[model samples]
Target: MQWTKLLCNYRELQLVGTLNGGQSFRWTYNKDTDEWIGVFSKTAWKLRQKDDYLEYQVLGSLLPEFSGNNTQIKNGNAKTCEESIFKSLLEKYFRLDVNLGSYYKEWSAKDELFKSACQQFYGIRMLNQEPVENLFSFICSQNNHISRISSMVEKLCTHYGEEICHHEGITYYAFPEVEKLSEAKVADCICLMSLNHLKALPVDTHVYQIAAQNYLPHLRGKKNVTEKMYAEIGDHFRLLYGDLAGWAHTVLFCADLKKFQSTDHKKEADEGVKAKKKRRQ
Candidate 1:
């Protein structure tokens, strides 16, 4: 398999946090390979980061065709054309056009709590996911944890989506299209999380907790988040974080996650032990 390099720094993109941290449920980390394996844009991908660049490998024969101009393929540049299309898909998926560092700086400047959170959780950017898939995934997310949500998503793909390929004993499938999903439902939060509407904040339990503890003490001790309270929370976040409130909300949400806390602290401790051992040697 040939690997292509994508120009991206750690400050701009962190693959582990961005892919696994409750954004999308498709990706799985291969600990042995230190790479992420996932299906996106009707193709399977193997992605890894090295210093300031991302290396990607298309895992199967299910490649997305060049939709813009067929002249390139007809002119005997099919490989190059396909590569370009795949790169474009990745760029869009990761929202590479957005300057994450600038947003981090802007967010940090506005909120001191956000500034502190940014120190530990940097490069956590919003993913531009497929709307249909995002809708189904987050719908599954309701009153569910990541593990169960992932399982449900896998089942959805396996049963409904078109089978792309089998690699390493795992069958990959494309996310089912709208026409294929007859019983599908919609969620408003899907727009903010997946549809590039960054200002639209989706107030859930996590957001409610963060808001009540810090922004709105009135929300504290409330048994449930009412419709009025939801609106108030969304308005407050928009007022605090401006147009990219959803993006900022995601960062805070990730920071407050127990999984992130345990994993991040463990990783840091492991790194610290390694450094100490190296120094002793």
Candidate 2:
């Protein structure tokens, strides 16, 4: 089946940022097809973002064990219910309910460092990814760039994962479960999904650098910041920010890595300040 939905007010839901936000790595863009390909439930769903709508096609569902269940069709609500389910999944996955404009306003007012990030990456929303997958993916992320992280994840899936589907000669597999990874000695990364549940920031060096320069001045003159301070710095940001601090951390961390530019941030900040001054004047 196929579906489409208009994702209005999606300036913040940039596909570039969503795929590149250092989260799940299965998403890729094929300029030739003008579509984004992501694997879900072993299906390579092709998605395209138009001006106001996301058009999607579910190539085919895999997991043969689950496919033969005609229960939904027998119930007679399959079409309507499944369509609604897909839309709801898309919304929740992309966090469409979040008011990016409001978050930008509040975060910008909160601090200069965040103000810069918010301005630079104004429309970058955090992807509310699958918890178990996100948990182990970050484990593979240590000292690794996004490309490497993605490659490792692909390998992990191909080797240990259950085959989902193949489309256009490309095969997509599910991420191996924690137990599978544990059996392979990659379980070290499974125990910790602390990136969100505990409300800790995904504070890499970029975030740490930004935090030290702007918030934790105590680390400014130090040559090396240790691992313990990662949690400490995250704690400090959450105190100032709140529960969604991890989301804010994703945007800001992108800036710190220069994945998002400082000049754009500076420009946005300058314009915001000018607007404020004009209002006061």
> lDDT of each structure?
0.81, 0.65
Off by over 4 Å in 1: 61-78, 183-186, 263-281
lDDT (C-alpha) at residue 115 in model 2: 81
Candidate 2 Cα deviation (angstroms), residue 268: 17
Residues 44-130, candidate 2: write the lDDT tens digits.
Answer: 566876545677665544445337743442233346556566567677667778777887778778877778656546667666655
TM-score of predicted model 1?
0.88
TM-score of each: 0.88, 0.76
Clash pairs, candidate 2, are 12-123
Question: Top model by TM-score, which number?
Answer: 1
